[model samples]
Target: MMDKMMATLLESLHEATQRLEQAVAVKESNPDDWLAILDEREELIHQMQERFSAGSVLTEAQRVQLTQIYEVNQRLIPLIEGCKQGVQQQLNNLHRSKLAMNSYNEAGPNGYGAFFDRKK
Candidate 1:
């Protein structure tokens, strides 16, 4: 029974990893679509956490697969970080441009001023 549970969890983990990788690729071209992938990944993670909390024993093969998953995650971390940084940079640029436009659009001292009666 434990072996079967472990196998199922392992399969889910593999599927999540594959989906995440696909998301990473799609993120550059179609970021909106990537959001749905992230949602699915989040749910898979929750399910995996529940299984771990249930304290199921695993066979040696399952342990090896888990280790492989860990290794794959290690590789994925940097790619995800790069994607995050790119998104942040885009946001910063957008904010700066918005500020610049607001400054340009502001009504700057129309010809008549409070000081007009005081001096040349």
Candidate 2:
């Protein structure tokens, strides 16, 4: 019974990771979807931890599955980081553009009066 429960949790974790991988593959995937998958995986990990703490032993097959999951996670790190950098770059560009627009607005016709004295 414990073994079956562990197996089911591991399978769910595996599927979650695969879904995350697919989400990452898309250039325009939503970060929320990635977060959702990570949340599901976290829950599975917690459940598995509880089972292990309750004295469940891992079968060889379960160990292999865990190893594969770890590898997939390792591969995902760089891709996720790349996505993060891309998002950060976009934000930076947006901030710069906003600043430019603000400067332009401030320098319009209203700003020129400040450079000259009305008494002159």
Candidate 3:
């Protein structure tokens, strides 16, 4: 039973990594697709984390496998974070531009428009 649980946990981690890679690669092309990938990966990670927290004893080989997974994750996490930051920055810039345009389009005063500086 322990071996089975370990196998499932390792499998989950591996699959999550692969899916995360795909999401990162195509993030700009179709962000909606990446969102779906994120949902699936989150479920897998949750299951894997539960298994890991159960205090199961891992053999040397299993420990080695887990270590490899950890190393890969260490490298991938920062890259993913950077990608997320870039996407957020783009969204922020877009929102700022939209607000600026809206403000500029607002009537100057009393519907007189920007051409007239004084109502008289």
Candidate 4:
């Protein structure tokens, strides 16, 4: 029984992680889709949390399996955080690029001297 519960909890955790990843992907591809994914992710995470808490009653083997899950999650969390940061950085860079492109477009290619001009 406890083994089955632990398995279910692990599966839930995996699903939640997948949902989170999908949300990140959707946000990158289509910003408007992010809200929906966020909603789903929240729901899945809540479910996973409930099951994980209940998994405290697991037996020795199940406990070991749970510990392994924890270790894997610990390793994965930093990578996930890094991925999120990378995505945010990419978005920031893209925004800056767009702004720079617009500014240059407005100023014309010959406007390079605008920066070096000594006139106040």
Q: What are the per-residue Cα lDDT tens digits for candidate 1 across 1-120?
A: 565665786778777777767667664456566567667767766876777788867678778877877787787789878877888999999999999766654635436443222222
Q: By TM-score, how accurate is candidate 3?
A: 0.65
lDDT of 2 by residue, 14-91 (tens): 999989999999989999999999999999999999999998888888889899999999999999999899999999
Number of clashing residue pairs, candidate 3: 0
Q: Model 3, stretches more than 4 Å misplaced? A: 26-55, 108-120
CA RMSD, predictions in order: 5.8, 4.7, 4.3, 6.6
Clashes of 4: 0
Looking at model 1, residue 48 earns an lDDT score of 67
lDDT of 4 by residue, 10-94 (tens): 5665565555455554434554454464566467557657766766455676567557656655765665577668879999999
Name the regions of candidate 1 deviating beyond 4 angstroms: 26-42, 108-120
Clashing pairs in 2: none
| Superior candidate under lDDT, 2 versus 3 | 2
On the 0 to 100 scale, the lDDT of residue 113 in model 2 is: 52
lDDT (C-alpha) at residue 65 in model 1: 75
lDDT winner: 2
The C-alpha lDDT values of all candidates are 0.71, 0.88, 0.70, 0.60
Candidate 1 lDDT: 0.71
Q: How does model 2 score by TM-score?
A: 0.86
TM-score of each: 0.70, 0.86, 0.65, 0.50
